[model samples]
Target: MAAVRIRIDLAYDGTDFHGWATQPGLRTVQGELQAALATALRLPETWVTVAGRTDTGVHARGQVIHLDVEDEVVIESAGRAKEPPLATLVRRLNGMLPADLRIHRAIEAPAGFDARFSAIWRRYAYRVADQPALVDPLRRHEVLPWQRPLDLSRMNAAATDLLGLHDFGSFCKARDGATTIREVQQLVWERDEAGVAVARVIADAFCHGMVRSLVGCLLEIGDGRKEVAWAEQILAEARRTSSVHAAAARGLTLEEVGYPPDEALAQRAEQTRGRRVLAE
Candidate 1:
């Protein structure tokens, strides 16, 4: 008779959905999740909360969310004498969900698995093309096609300016209640096996448009259009400038989130992030 916690690992292409949140008459990740839960558990739409809300045209590979429901609904309940297995729940959700959305994994969560609050870090990857010939038509939505040859060395140098904690207001969209300052734990620009330019960033948190704005600035440096000091100057100024042109959202992906082995890792990450904000 006790309530159970359910954690779902899911992914979806944001092209078809209007971001992650539910809206009136609009298709969204939350809307699909609510419907799936409703059919599987015979519940209503008000029982789910996601860890993050991505913007339109974005994508996620390892998004996590938690829901509270009756034990019989999640297949782990001892109260249900004849319920199906957890795997069946996953299979059923996938069968009912659309092609673009999938249930990557599902499980009964541990006692304190607060999806949003317990996360330590989030990682994202952005891909940009330096050569037009290398782009495959099939992968166009997932990679930005930049025909101009880029200077990898210059891009890497510019990225160095963004490696530490700073107020990234220039690169982020202003939010009424959210903070623009964040601790960037890792950032790099390099060529991958296919010789395509890639940008990777990891941080405890990100503000709206932060990753895209960062990419916009990095591209300028790579194209010989700006100096490395330009990145530093923009950060120091802490204001949006015409130079920051974010790449298409479809080229970015939410790679993964870092969680502590125990609560200590989360605590450490939170403290580090807090200090970074204050110093900024």
Candidate 2:
């Protein structure tokens, strides 16, 4: 039987899991989800491909993944005759998953849809409460509390200079053989009604540790510790620097991922698979 590609939209509180990927003896979102799916379908263990691999303690509101399984596995009802097999799978998996994780939807994927490679952009938001009064105890898990007050004007000004395509090595954890170059479609700082500082960062893709490192550098500039010119200087270096610390993972959340239309999925995937380099 032919394999069926399934698209799953999920959300998770990453505080408990090690991260998105699975590792020996570690609790992870992928590990738990895969285990639950395998059990529900009565099939062997399977792997999933995610659009974004968030770091430890990072949350995701719009995470996406895809997995391929034999058609028979998806159609098996497991004695639940009331609903279709796909619906049954969703209901059963949700029953087995922990409270912090949720599978929002499951459907047959469009042709050529790849959760990771076909993605056009990923949008993330970082929340920081610079003033003690603005920090809400209920939101402590998702927001970062900082001792110093932040200047929104300064942070926005610094963020403006960092937009557009460029090498972001200075803001990424160095990984061997992985390119540090990325395109920043949007990076803006604003204060919400609650007076908490929010940074909305949209990029074609982010290298490992890129979003938090960018937030850390901007926080310094907002608090008067670093000059506005500092961000530009760091970008010019095109290499990682110790001066920028990755912001606490608790403040970051994967907001959304964008993809091309159904007809263009394959083309987009092909384009993304090519090695990326800054134009000369």
Candidate 3:
């Protein structure tokens, strides 16, 4: 009757859901996944911890979550299949999940595996169709339409000064008792084959609305409305200002989540539990 922790790698089109958390009446990724998991595993209820809690319209390509379930149930889920239990579990999960959501992999978690806390960094990508010709109607849900064409070089240049550890208060929504200090490992803009601008931002952890706000600020510089120094000046002030607009959530996607080696998971989780503060 021992319980086994399971790690799930999945993706979802967040166009219609109300984000990742469960709500009383609204449809959410967490709610849908938990209901499907409970039905597939024949459990009364299920709970999962997610690596990142995305906004309502934001999508995800490489999301991670963890749950604990009875060991017998997992094996029994295979149900006469010759494949491994984990493989069967994933296959069965996908069958039960809605078309917008998918289960890529599901396996027994290693010791100390905590999906949220064990994550070392998260990568998010935002796509913008700055011109009418570049806007594709077929992919309307994931891309944002902008008023002006974006300059990739300008956005990349302006992103350099915002890298490394800094208080991102100007780019984040205020949260009680939460520090906005974060280490931005990467922030670069590039154009896709369709001539749409794409921004890839990676950070140890993002405060609420951090990536969207950063993209909004860089977008102005990319369009020649704001100078490169504006980004640095905002960071130096470390306070939220009206100049930094939060880009549309539909444009942003959680691309990946990085984690340390299995042996370090416990330590990393413990370290992440402490509240962060900027050094004086």
* lDDT of every predicted structure (CA atoms): 0.79, 0.92, 0.92
Winner by TM-score between candidate 2 and candidate 1: 2
Off by over 4 Å in 3: none
Shift of residue 238 alpha carbon in model 1, Å: 1.9
lDDT of 3 at 127: 96
lDDT of 3 by residue, 173-277 (tens): 999888898999999998889888999899999998899999999989999999988899988889899988999999999999999999999999999998877
On residues 81-186, what C-alpha lDDT tens digit does candidate 2 reach at each position?
6777777778888999999999888889999999999999999999999997998999998999999999989988999889999999999888989888889999
Off by over 4 Å in 2: none
**Candidate 1 stretches greater than 4 Å from native:** 76-84, 265-276
Which candidate tops TM-score?
A: 2
Ranking by TM-score: 2, 3, 1
Write model 1 residue lDDT over 1-280, tens digit each, in one string: 7787778888888788888888999998898878887887655554676666788888888888888887755654223445445666777789889998898877887755667766778889888777877797887777888868989788888788887778888998887766778889988877889987888889878888899888888888888888988888899878777778887898888878776665464555355444344542
Compared with the true structure, the alpha-carbon lDDT of candidate 1 equals: 0.79
